[model samples]
Target: MKPLTPRLHGFVDYTACGLMLAAPRLLRLSPQARRASYALAGSYLGVSLLTDYPPALRRMIPFPVHGRIELATFPALLLLASETQGRNRIYFLALAGMVAGAYALTDWKADPDA
Candidate 1:
């Protein structure tokens, strides 16, 4: 069985979002990479807030659907990482790895409850 419950995953999502929002500044990335980091942070926050999980602001996205979305986005994240260079590449690759690890650990099959 997967190790993370939906509620735990929600916390992880928020934490990752915060890190993404801070990465550009913390990593001293280029302008383009900074913008991309901000965009990714916003998107991650939106998904977390909309997911049907304990920490969400709304219940629009079911837990399993969230998992599916993550799965679908993984390849795109890899592509984005491949297109970047230096710290930008490292940031994107790290984000992708974080997502992959979270996806693997989350108990997506369990009911989403607080």
Candidate 2:
């Protein structure tokens, strides 16, 4: 069963976007790290805005497809996250793992009606 419903996923998406946008300052990250964090934040926010969810603006893309894109993109995020050191690295790894695992567990292909 999908652990995260579309509504819950929407919450998570917004929360993650905020966290990504704030992490660089919160963690006192390097310039490259800050840029990466900003980029991810922007991308996440953009996707969420365009996603076909209750909170979305344009609703151009289906929510499940957005989830799939997140699933596909997180590994690349992990790779970029590897550039960090110490606790920041651990944080990134943990965040990436949590997101990937969450996406994996959710049934993105399931019928919205059922």
**lDDT: which candidate is best?**
1
* Overall lDDT per candidate, in order of appearance: 0.87, 0.77
- What lDDT tens digits, residue by residue, belong to model 2 across residues 51-114? 7766777888887889878887778768876777876677678768868877866667654333
Clash totals, every prediction: 0, 0
After TM-score superposition, the amount by which residue 35's alpha carbon in candidate 2 deviates from its true location, in angstroms, is 0.8
* Model 1 ranges off by over 4 Å: none
Model 1: colliding residue pairs:
none
RMSD of each: 1.1, 2.0
**Candidate 2 lDDT trough over 10 residues, lowest sum:** 105-114
- Pick out the ten consecutive residues of candidate 1 with the lowest summed lDDT: 69-78
